[model samples]
Target: MKILIVGNGARESALGVKLQEDKRISKIFFAKGNATTDNIGQNYFESDIVSLRNLAIQENIDLTIVGPEAPLVDGIVDDFRKHDLKIFGATARCAKLEGSKAYSKKFMQTYNIKTAKAQVFEAYHDAIAYVKNHDYPLVIKASGLAGGKGVVVCEDVLEANATIHKFMIDRIYGDAGIQLVIEDFLEGYEVSIIAFSNGQKLFPCIPAKDYKKAGKGETGANTGGMGSAAPSPEWTAENQIDFEKNILEPTIFGLQEKNLNFRGFIFFGLMVTKNGCYLLEYNMRLGDPETQVLMALLENNLVDTIESCLNGDDVELKFSDKKAVCLVICSGGYPQNYETGFEIKGTDKVEHSTLLFAGASREAKRIVTSGGRVLSLVATGDSFDEARDKVYADALPIHFDYAYYRDDIGKF
Candidate 1:
């Protein structure tokens, strides 16, 4: 079977590698994929939905798996369906779960899901006034998608006002910040739960901890994600059960009640505090660095899993028992200003691991930085410590100008 995967991040690279391992797949194509993906499949045209659809038709691609939320939000699945093409992703309507924070908050409230208290605002003055009236340390979020950097935690009125100004007036996140959701800050251990669904049954993957802060000791602005490790120490079976009962089940049932045909991956960003799991946010597609680690430990064929979902089959997803860790090496001034196109070196020395390219390209046979989050080094072992050590050791061989990464992922 010929397969087509969308997006050009490390997640897509990981998916491409896994799908290529399936003997049933005769040909594989990546839309706007990066350097590492080129080793796994035939890199095709850019990620334009129309061009991809045409290519799929011409090549007789059997399956198209979307790896990012942008095309999903732009209605790529809907467009593919129009041409009677089989694709794996939620429709634009179901993608509102991540596209609009206000809509998600309202859905949570309607379904009695455990989440932080929040208020949505359109006008800048109203949002600022609400922040001042509330108290200190609130989370200011862009109602629309902002590549995971839209949410800012304000420690005081000054910071809150500044964030509001940056998002609403200055338009820091483009039109995504036109409206905002100011939420009460909740403190706890954060974990990400990515699940597969077929509008009927839900299959949750091993919980992973994402290091959002740009620097060590969890300080600095949030980028896409600096690093991640699977089977987080805090994610006990009890906590998993609580999450399934309190968050996952309710969310699926709520979407069902609304008559929304929710399919594809559903990501739950949760803060597991003493008060139990509280919803932080939702992502429509797989998490980036987390996907790198999780896919490294996956023992089954990705094509089979996604095809089962698309076919509405009663499929049971499985994963390896080994622990995994992925470290994202980014440009020096990430989540802000940074330079790109600098030639990268040292990848040749990496052994017994996977290096999934995320913001990189081949410049005259040499890999170079291309985006904020550059590449991911993934490793797996019997224990988290072993995996962490292997990942860092492998990362040592890869270098580029202004390469920055967190040193304390999974240390807690």
Candidate 2:
């Protein structure tokens, strides 16, 4: 089978590695892939969705998998299906769950899904007034996609005013902030559960925990993700049962009731609190650094699992008992201003962990930083300590100008 993966990041890189394990897969292709992916499959440097669909048809791709949210939300799957191309991803209408926070919040409310109370606003004055009346420590989020950097936790009216001004007035996130969702902050640790859905049932993968803060000790602004680990320490068997019953089943039922034929990944961002788990947000596809670690712990053939899910067959996803850890190496000043093009070294020397490139390109036969979050090193072991040790030991040698990484990953 020939497979085409759409995206150009570490998550796509990891997908390539996992898909390759399926011996039935004879060829792999990437759409506008990065330096790391170039080494794993045939890279097609194209960005247009129509052209990508044509490429899939041209290559006779048996299945095309989408790895990024932007394209999926933009209707890539819809476009492909229109041409009778087999693709894996949610339709644009269904993607609204991730593309628009306001829309998703409404969906949750309608389905009675457990989530924080929130109000959506379109006017600056209305938002300001709403914030003034709300309690402190509110979460202000852009209605549209902001690459995971749209939400901010405001501690006071002053901060809330500034964030609202930045998102609505200053247009920091452009049209993404044309509207915003102001919600009460849910206090708890976060767990990311990605499930394979066929519009009816769900096959949940191992829960993952990711550090979004750019600085150590959870300081600084949020980035794509700093680091991550699989089998989140916060996820208990009881939590699993509760999630499947209260969250997963309801989500599937809601999709079916809404007539949304979703056949792709459903990412649930949950905040486990003393009260219970509250849904934070929904993502149409897999999370970045989280994917790096989950791919390491997954023992099932990804292609088979996805196909089985799409067929609505009873498929049990298998995962390694070993714990996995991922440490992200980034260009300094990431999730904000930072320079790229710096030559990356020691990637070839890292032997203790697996290297998945996120933001890098080849120049003069050498790899150089091309984006903020560059790559991730993932390691798995019987224990989290062993995985963390392996990941850190291998992460030490990688170098780039102004490169930085969090030191507290997998500390739990």
Candidate 3:
């Protein structure tokens, strides 16, 4: 059967690789795919997902998997359903889980899901005053989409006030800055749990821990992501249970209670503290680097797993015992100002790892940089350290003029 996948990032490239592994799939088509994906299947760049939807209907594509949050949040799934075309993703209503931090926080409270104590604010001056009155070190979040750069952890009232001005007064995050969620910061280890849902049964993938800090040693401002390792060492058995009891189960119930009809992947950002697992945030779709590593660890037929979930069939996901690690090569000055269109080199030399292109495209038979996060190098080994080492080794060959990567991913 022919399959259509949405997106043009490393996550879509990785998904293309895994989706092709399913015995039932005969052809794979990508919507606006990148250079790495071009090698795996056909890339459609004529228009946008709407054109892809028309193509899917014309070709009678069996299934479509969405890889990004923007389309999902924009009601692509709803549109596809209106045409009677099968697509995998949450509807616009369900997308509020990630589209608005305030909505998600309220949902957590409505369901009694444990999370940071927070309040939402619309006025910039009011938010600044709240920060001044509050104690030091609070989490300030822009309520809308910022491609993961909207949240700031302020260490002092001074820093908090500055960040507040950056978001509220300066409008750094654009429309995403119109509102903010100021919450009490919790100290703990952060782990992300990705799960497949059919608006009913939930299938959790192997836990992955993402390093959000821009620089090594957890310094600098937060970017989309640096790197990640699967089966995070910080995920203890006790916390897993707490997550299921307090966060996971309650989340599913709340979604169903709202008649959200949410289908597709959900990412639960959790912080395991001395008290318990606190739901940090909700991402309506899979995490980027998280998807890169998780795909490496996935041992099941990806098509069957997703189709089964979509059809509401009893399905259990299979995963490899081997450890998986992903290293992201980014353009210099990324998560900020960065130039693209530079010719890249050394990717052909990478042999031991799976190279998935993110911010890159082919120009005149040459692979060139195209986005902020350029590529994802993933490898599996007997252990996390070994896998991380292999990924770094493979990353040495792929070079761009302003490429920079963190050296300490998966390092405890």
Q: Residue by residue across 192-297, what tens digits does model 3's lDDT show?
A: 9999987687889989989899898888989988999998977888988899999998988998899886679999999888999999999989899899999999
For candidate 1, write residues 277-369 as lDDT tens digits: 999888888988788878887776787888777777766767888888888899999989999999889988888678899899877788889
Clashes of each: 0, 0, 0
Global lDDT of model 2: 0.90
The residue-by-residue lDDT of candidate 2 on 1-412, one tens digit each, is 9999998989999999888788899889998788878888889989789889888988899999998998999999999988988888999998999999999999999998889999999999999999887888999999999999999999999999999999998999999998999999988899999988866777889999999999988889988999999999878988887787777778888998999877899899999998778899999998898898889888888888888866777678889999999999999888999999999998888998989888899998799999999998899999999999998998888989999999999997
**Off by more than 4 A, model 1:** none
Question: For candidate 1, what is the TM-score?
Answer: 0.98
TM-score of 2: 0.98
Tell me the lDDT of model 2 at 275. Answer: 79
Could you tell me which residue pairs clash in candidate 1? none
Query: What's the true lDDT of residue 368 in model 3?
Result: 92
The order of the candidates by lDDT, greatest first, is: 2, 3, 1
Better of 2 and 3 by lDDT: 2
**Which lDDT values do the candidates have, in the order given?**
0.87, 0.90, 0.89
Supply candidate 3's per-residue lDDT for 395: 85
